[model samples]
Target: MRRIGLCISLLVTVFVMSACESEDEAQTFADRDQETVKHTTVKPMSNKNKQDFQTLPNDMQLAIVFSSMIRVSEAFDYGIGNPEYFVRSSMTEGEADIAKENLESIQFENKQLKKQNNEAVALLQKTHNQEMSHNEMQQLKENRTAFFEVTESMIKLISQVTPKNAKKTRQQLDQLKKQYTQYSAESVKIMNSIVKKQGADKASFERHLETMLQKQPGQPMLSELY
Candidate 1:
């Protein structure tokens, strides 16, 4: 009976030891899984946070250029008045070059469009020697209106592309908004003068505006106003 009792006690000890080993193994696995989950979980960075130039699209590159221009222009408009304010945001020398190129392109395109518009107006005046029909006159008025509308939009867009300080950006934007309002009034006066002198109808004006819009490169995806 003593031997049997000793055997039974030994059996019980073995079972308890096995159970403890199994529990320890399960706890170790659980801990490892938790660590793996922690390591795998990560936050995705936003496009705005990315600093690399190569990652940006062509339109975005152009926008950066325009943004710099806007900032510089705004600085001058707001009494900050430094050209460096525009180019300072560029990440690299190459980016600065690109920005400069974009500005040049925009200026060039504006000049070309203005020249074309003047020529079109002149041609219209030459063609309409006699009194035109009321319908023809109305058409001319509509075209002139559309052209001015597009011009104002372009100015506003250009102004919006300018970058500003975080503290003053909002104020700068407000200034741009006001400037656009004034710009529109001035544009209307100019358009009326062109129409009155040239007798060019609205259809010709719209076609010219459309051509200008088509010539302009595609805007950036990130642009706030295009």
Candidate 2:
């Protein structure tokens, strides 16, 4: 009877150990599955963030290049007269320092974009003349995309206002918004000039530009203005 009792006790211990092992294995597999799902979700999101510059139509690319050029030119012009407004400010000292660093980066990028604007204009002229190569046009599109991306980043930064500087920031942004309206008008004139200069009747370019502008995230749509 004692031997029988010991045998039963051993059997129960073995069963418990086996159950524990099975549960541990199941948990390990569950952790691995979660990791795999996380990786799968993250990879596609990273890829989705990348802009497919090559997929854009050539006409649309030209309009983007023109739009970027107009914005860059307007920013430069506005900075010349309102140099104080170009300086970024923040509430805390740490944030103020960061703002300074961002402003410096923005200034550098804007200068570079300004330099490229002449090249962009030359490319537009080449495009109008039907002399631009596929490679050259593609390069223009990529450059303009980069230009707009930088400008968009700067604009977003400026649009944000802390409680300390809300009024000042709004005042600055208001001035910039007026300038943006001027930019749209100037873009229209520039596009008309380009078409007239090329003796081309493809008003489709204007339509394309309008569509692209309407898709911009924050700014008021040109269509709404009319």
Candidate 3:
């Protein structure tokens, strides 16, 4: 009977040890998982104060504006092409309804911008070793104007319809709007002079601009929000 009691005690002791081990293992795994999550989590984009584009060099300012225009144009194309998808993914029904109300107008704006983008691309491609004609330069000015005007209109409409709960999106839109204001005014005067050169000056500028365009990287600042 003493041997039997000893055996039972041993078994009880082993059982308690096993339970304790299992709990310790579970806790170790839980801690590791918490550490992994802490390391892997993605933080939200911060709104850092950026230097005004107007303060940048003329070439740099134009590069940014041109790159932003291209990125935003691509975004507009995606939204226009997949209206249902965009609405479903990014907006509530109420917001979708508001977007739909001005759908035609926005579509028209997109169409105009696309036309100008095509023109600019073609002009740049053929002007590799030559100067742009006065007419071509004029067209570029018009295209730049259209880009800012259309983008402003689009931003305002999106801002108006964006849900208040979309804090990140609203912040992004505001930042973009602020950028638009910076690049659209005095920067225009600089861009005009840059594009309005003649003879050798025009050719050099065109080649430089074309090379920049050809190697232009994607602008996530404008693309992510759209």
By TM-score, the best candidate is 2
Q: Candidate 1 — which pairs collide?
A: 67-161, 70-162, 71-162, 71-163, 139-202, 140-201, 140-202, 143-202
Model 3 alpha-carbon drift over 4 Å, by segment: 1-96, 108-112, 124-167, 199-226
TM-score of each: 0.25, 0.34, 0.30
- Could you give candidate 2's per-residue lDDT for residues 1-226 as a string of tens digits? 0000011122122222322122222111111111111111101113434444335444544555554454444333332213224334445545444434434433544545555465455545445343434444445455455535534543554535354774576466556544443333334344444444444434555566555443433232111100
**lDDT score for candidate 3 against the true structure:** 0.37
Weakest 10 consecutive residues, lDDT, candidate 3?
1-10
Mind giving the per-residue lDDT tens digits that candidate 1 earns over 6-103? Answer: 11122122222322222222111111111121111112235665455434433333223222222222212211111112334323445444333433
Question: For model 2, what is the alpha-carbon lDDT of residue 96?
Answer: 42
Q: Which stretches of candidate 2 lie over 4 Å from their true place?
A: 1-90, 124-173, 201-226
TM-score of 3: 0.30
- The per-candidate count of clashes, in order, stands at 8, 0, 0
Q: Candidates sorted by lDDT, descending order?
A: 2, 3, 1
Stronger candidate by TM-score (1 vs 3): 3
TM-score of 1: 0.25
Better of 1 and 2 by TM-score: 2
What tens digits encode model 3's per-residue C-alpha lDDT throughout 32-103? 111121121112123464454334433443343344344333334333222222233356757666555434
